[model samples]
Target: MAMKAIDPQYTADTKYALEVRNVDIYYSAFRAVKNCSFGMERNKITALIGPSGCGKSTVLRSLNRMNDLIAGARTEGEVLYRGQNLYDPDIDAVQVRRSIGMVFQKANPFPKSIYDNIAYGPRVNGWKGSKAEMDELVERALRGAVLWDEVKDDLKKSGLAISGGQQQRLCIARALAVEPEVILMDEPCSALDPISTLKIEELMFELRQRYSIVIVTHNMQQAARASDNTVFFLMDKEDRAGQIVEYGPTEQIFQSPKDERTEQYISGRFG
Candidate 1:
């Protein structure tokens, strides 16, 4: 059977595929994310674009609770997944991560074979299936990631054996194997060359057909081209905090943003 996603309608007004409601994140006594609230539509690509250290990646990691690993990193408010509060004490952070996947910049593939990298998730989750089934899942994931043709004959090769671009795609396939509902990517193309960046941008469009993708990127042009919605974050007056400066349909934000900071950032006048 095919993998079915959270319904499109349910992904929309039904609390969004992922909703960050009045979120406040702090590192020890210092606040990072202010009372931020946003809803991500289902199967859509939402780009979180901002300058360096503007908390774009922070928000992305918050979606999957990756920030919790930091000793003093604290989060307040709710990260709702399909209407359920992800921060609820009853929720399993591991389970939350499985359902909502993430890919980081630099294409940090595992030190294992390509096959093992993709199989790792399901295996740890007790897939306990036949070899054929595992093989099928691997191929399906690679194809979904648009990487099968480049890697099919060399599944036994170490993941690090591939080119930088291909390694990123392999990482993407690894995320896909679990069939997660959301894919949180942090500056995914920052480490790639222009050609590789273009390829990843194209991949982002294709991936959105099945998964809700939230990406944090410093490249404004990439955001304009790949995302359905754009969220622009900029540092505050103290330069110690960041907030969402502007957010709306990609067209609006790029064409005529409501804030002066957005225009400055988009036009490359200021950070």
Candidate 2:
């Protein structure tokens, strides 16, 4: 099927930290997401919320070319990071991921020590520093994710040995270790308990002071509470391809959405 979007002409101004411009994602001939577009502001959180299989995660992964890791998966249109199209052939996907880091729905820590998990990215990215500098970096990252106090004495412990919530925070700290300009989270709290979820949300609030964040979440209340902007997606029944249906401030989206579909979904009328 030909690709299309509910808001096909969407654009972002210079103030945006990153922007998806009429992007379509596909695996082979199967289009997973239609021309979805939205902007993420610097030092702010933008949440992508929708029902299952609406391509919320697909779109989030596209920001850093994570989709490229899938066989035959490709993206169409522009994904601008610092004014450069990330899909361009000259762009390095590795560097893209390094700059725009990601945390998955599940906590996937490396089978290494907590300190090593945090050091891995920087090492791969050619970070050359003394032991003290590397140690400081690790401490800063753990503290940034709010995991230092709990795991400070356990830096030598295996990342997998930590609690699920702590493991997720460790994954987050791993992302921050490289000092990414933007963080893409695919339901970072979905696997955690309520308390853990709240901690992640609060950490997001604090992290936004230094990094731009884009989160794909199914939780409507979480989106309303944690994000400055929200984009609602819906699948086109005919094509089974997802598209952005509404995009605006979180308050407007929750209180007075311009689209009735957004209202119905958020109000628990239908997914």
Candidate 3:
């Protein structure tokens, strides 16, 4: 299939809140991502679509430097956040992760209480507010995730005690409490039921006014329904590496994608 994102001169706007430029990733000697690039508009949701192992999740993890946790995983090229390249030697990956938070496919919360889960980031970063202030922030975060009413009475309950969907929302609340400028989610709704997925989708809409969101999903309908833009990924010739094939407005990409691979993937013919 024709790869539409290959034009090397195609530079996305820095006015965008986030930018991925010719990014390549590797695990030890094996390359897993090859020259993927895209730009994300401020406070908008951008969906990454591809088959499993097509580097969608890898790209998402690279954004906040999660891949760095692995001993042999390394990335080539730079991820620019608000004009600054995140991979620069001078940049602190920790700060980068804080500015851009992440959510995973499975809902994973600490064994700690719900209150502690929401307060974890802020506390670690030194949030020294009065009890009333912390309480308000926690409530706001829970409400933002649309979980306050259900768990408000049980703030002391372990976050793991909640249902899968509720736990996912709680994870979202924890990410929000840090007041990040960008949030990355990897297949967040894959394990959720229809009702719960709708809530998360609705939450994405509500969040766009304040936070830039990037999501990786195999769900074409969810990507088309929830995101303003989409990036379609594909495997390299050897099938050992993945790369972006196309990126554009969601309507354009889904309805009239410039790349044949994108069309095939979105139309359920392939992924």
- Residue 133 in candidate 1 has what lDDT? 97
TM-scores, each model vs. reference:
0.94, 0.94, 0.93
Kindly give the stretch of ten consecutive residues in candidate 1 with the minimal lDDT sum.
Answer: 3-12
Clashing pairs in 1: none
> What residue pairs are clashing in model 3?
none
For candidate 3, write residues 38-108 as lDDT tens digits: 99889899999898888889899999999999999999998987667888766767788888999999999
Candidate 1 has a TM-score of 0.94
lDDT digits (tens) for residues 91-162 of candidate 2: 778778878999999999999999999999999999999999999999999999999999999999999999
Q: Arrange candidates, best lDDT first.
A: 2, 3, 1
Writing each residue's lDDT as its tens digit, candidate 1 over 1-271 gives 3433333344335736888998988999988878788888888999999888788899999999999899999989999887678887767778788889989988999999999999998988778789999999999999998999999999999999999999999999999999898999988899999998898889988999888999998888888989999988877777477788888899999999999889888999977
Positional deviation of residue 110's Cα in model 2 after best superposition, in angstroms: 0.6
TM-score result, candidate 3: 0.93
Give the lDDT of residue 205 in candidate 3. 97
